[model samples]
Target: MSSTISDPASDGVVRAADGTPLKQRLNRALRREKLRSFLLILPLLAFIVLSFIMPIADMLFRSVENQIVEETIPLTVVALKEWDPASGEAPGEEVFAAFHADFVQAFKDKKHTRLGLRLNYDEPGMSGLFRKTGRPSTKMQPPYKEAFIKVDEDWGTVETWAVIKQASPAYTDGYFLNAVDAHRTAKGIEMVPENERIYLFLFGRTMFLSIVITMSCLLLGYPIAFLLASLPLRSSNMLMILVLLPFWTSLLVRTSAWKVLLQQQGVVNDFLVWIGLVNDADRLIMINNQFGTIVAMTHILLPFMILPLFSVMKTISPNYVRAAKSLGANDWTAFWKVYFPQSIPGIGAGAILVFILSIGYYITPELVGGTSGIFISNRIAYHISTSLNWGLAAALGTILLALVMLLFYVYDKIVGIDNVKLG
Candidate 1:
């Protein structure tokens, strides 16, 4: 009577009615569930990998993938490896012979000119030197050094040979270095001359303008969002339409409209003059400057900020504020202590959205931002389209990506990304 009943599974060998261990059965079921979940999301995963990850990875690789020179003149690279650039003279007959062996066909195939153009990014005369030496370099005999030197004295200079050797590697950090306004030379890495140091300035301007735009959106959007959330269902739904109206129109059209409005003689300045706030003779220089870029971008991105804020604010209970007020808190004190903290998640979400979008935006900035306001992205576009310097463009893009990621990390650290929510 006093004996305790033996517990089922006391031996830790629980089994199903079919005599299978329950743990094993549970694990098998979990495996099937995991497989099913993975299959459901497989399409989305593939789309992200193909559309976003692959393209970004390719761009990142292109930042360091500088194989054209190595591929075009393999023999010259090998010959020059043993030659010392410190000697203040060009390589001897062996190096000249190796270069000539490859130069004729490369020039004929137009590969040499492309290589020259690439090398010329670092060494100014390389493109012209390669072009001038093309057909004539083919006729030069065993004493290739003397013949090449007579054709172009630049060919005999240590600086010229040094540049080629520097560019001979299949992969390089030169593009990235140049992106930060530095260059690779016989002196190792050095900052470019002050006048040529424009990329850093553009980076600074891009970051500064992007911050200004984000702050502008936040300030302008918070009130609209609070108003929308505070309204009744019917009124809020009607007001929401106006907030979304911008999405129906073309972005280019909006930017162009801003251009028309912000131009010196455009509607904005014309109205200001009419109101006598500004003199007609001294119209504000709005278009093609930082002010134009900021105003246009802030207007364009404000809706993005408002939507997030509204969604989160709508979820917040007005009861909390009422309770604080009932507990003897003043209107301002209750809002500052209770309502603002709860709305911070919305602020975080909207700030991240507007900031990231504003940082990468080139179209709006390009149209409104002139020489002074143009961002690093504009320079990236220039290198890609006009200069065909894809390496530099890729490097600049990679740097921008890193910068955005850094800002995200900082925000996460400061505000806690876990606290950021749209609703």
Candidate 2:
């Protein structure tokens, strides 16, 4: 038990009972502890990567991915590279011959329709041209230019080949350009026609409405939160159940209930008629517009605002307001200067949560928000499910994500994220 090794390393150092240097043993133990900690968190890390990171990565990749045109007509793309779009005429006979090969092969494989769709996004009539030419393209002779013109006049135009050359790249910024309501043409990047400009307006509307919803929640929830914080324990607990009652119900059910209440002949209109606020025949139109979306969403998101404000207010001591009043400050001055300032962290936290939720909310906006009120998210959903344009959907989603991140960064810089308190 008293044996000691005469090792150089352990001359003046403490040793373990097994005669190993204590410092070496401690370093080994520390490494083991670190590895154990990493092992414990490995499952959560893997879950985050698989569920969140991978999908986002795939979306970013798809945003700029445009391989369908190139993959469908490789020889045509190569042939058209040297053809000048400004020639004010169709590509040469040789170029048409190159495309003739790709056209026949793609038709045989039944991929010409897909290629047509990809090109149709840039030039509208290409889909019909490709589909109409599908079968006849097989019987075309060596003089493809004359045969193509005979089949369809579009094949004899420069606009047709220009779109093909533009979309020939394996990867492109076309989707992102389209996301901002612009397009890449043979000339250069330019905004779409005024009638086609939608994405930018929707983006602005989404941000504006989200802010309005956040402000509405704050204004309505603040007083309630203050009352909750000031009330006696049993009464506050009972009041809190009322606040939390909406959470117990399904979101769809709650939105549907709002629909029944806000419709033209619904309970709200009936009540207004009874109160003589307006004529019975002149019922308000509120159910399927911006107003309805704001009302329904504010009600749904109010709890998010109230809970944080209440939690923070509950931590603020009553004695601070009392001390201010004792120092000759009026009741309003004391409450405003001391108590309200103290509760700002909660306001910040609640605003962030509600705004973020409102911006991304699709179901509520889709249900209550008719044509004029739907958010950009609704358009993204339509692209993904209905249009099946994953590229455009991914670009829109990436932009939305970037917008949220930029706002978060600005908020952090202005308000200091560390100052926000949930409790």
Candidate 3:
């Protein structure tokens, strides 16, 4: 006789003595599987939190922070409680007295003076004010009001007091406003001067360049993606490897190569002149300009656009286009009205990826485009490293982040990000 095994589902082999259903045993197994899956995901969750989330949070904090105000004029901030921001006039003499005291103390402490100078470097005329206040001689006198009055005489003026009253708070929105081409005055909002304006221009240029490059990539990449998608699997894979070959090269090397290719004495210029395309080599404005940047960036970023499009195009059935053609639609109409619309997800994803990356790029623009073509990120880096102005750098970074977020939000609203299906 064959040995008979009890069926867990039918015979309830794991049932409790109280006669509970074998369903409980199945539930226990299911829960164990779920727990094991969660355990497997735990490390990834920790990695995301530690590596990405925490650093972003720290950066955001640094962007809007006002530590200088807190440390420099603690007493003034406390004393100016009665001063109303809405009233928009100078605070009482008591606020000035507190400032005087703080300045005197901070002046005596060389370290604190240096800290104040560093913090205020971004603000126009602040370096001078800090230097004046941070002097050792400025500390020797009790209540340095006389010295302060001598420097500007506005020290006693309502406007001077108003400026201090406005700036006295331990926290501020000043840096943020300045970063976005907006300025906060006693009256209202206004545009910054052209000479003083940097971020706004860079931001606009960055956006414009990114859009142009993305469009160029889309126009060029779409045909290539379609060709690859139509090919056999083996042929398509080979083509894909060729398309992705640029990724193996270093970014700097590629950019430098473009520089060499586009220069006045380079092959491109020689060909143009030889082919009688232009009367002179000087006619080709290829290097150290927007054209150079666009060419190099589009070349570097083309793979990003192509891969998504290729993946999307591959999934789309060729029969749909044929079906549309059979219904008497022209080939171009069938493609535009049927096939192209289906490729929207890939287009959106690739455009967004390239745009965001392009805006933050510094090296290519700095190297090939020169001072005239520098982006906001270049200025931010300069402020941090050369000027040693962390506050300005943070403020610039915050503005860039906000703009990128705004762009993402607008894109999401127009076409839901969730709708994107990447193979």
Ranking by lDDT: 2, 1, 3
lDDT of 3 by residue, 1-423 (tens): 111434344543555545665568778879999999999999999999999988777767776676766576688768877767566554556666777787767776655555445445434555565676566445444445565666655455554445555665556676677677777666776778778787778888887888888899999998999999999999888887888788667899999999999988888988889999877826687888888888998998888788877877888999999999999999999999999999887788778867877888888988887666667888888987997766668888877888788878866775577855443
- lDDT for model 2 comes to 0.90
Q: Compare the candidates by lDDT and give the number of the best one.
A: 2
Give one digit per residue, the lDDT tens place, for model 2 in 85-157.
9888889999999999999999999999998988887878889999999999999997989999999998888
What TM-score goes with each of the models? 0.90, 0.92, 0.82
In angstroms, give how far residue 313 of model 1 lies from its true place. 2.6
Could you give candidate 1's per-residue lDDT for residues 152-242 as a string of tens digits? 9998899999999988888999999999999987778899999989899888888899999999999999999999999999999998888
- Candidate 3 backbone overlaps, count: 0
Residue ranges of candidate 3 with Cα displaced over 4 Å: 1-32, 82-97, 111-123, 136-139, 151-154, 279-283, 327-330, 403-423
Better of 1 and 2 by lDDT: 2
Tell me the TM-score of model 2: 0.92
Model 3 C-alpha RMSD vs. true structure (Å) is 4.7
Q: What do the candidate models score in CA lDDT, each in turn?
A: 0.89, 0.90, 0.75
Residue 165: error of model 3 in Å?
Answer: 2.8
The candidate with the higher lDDT, 1 or 3, is: 1
Stretches > 4 Å off in candidate 2: 1-10, 408-423
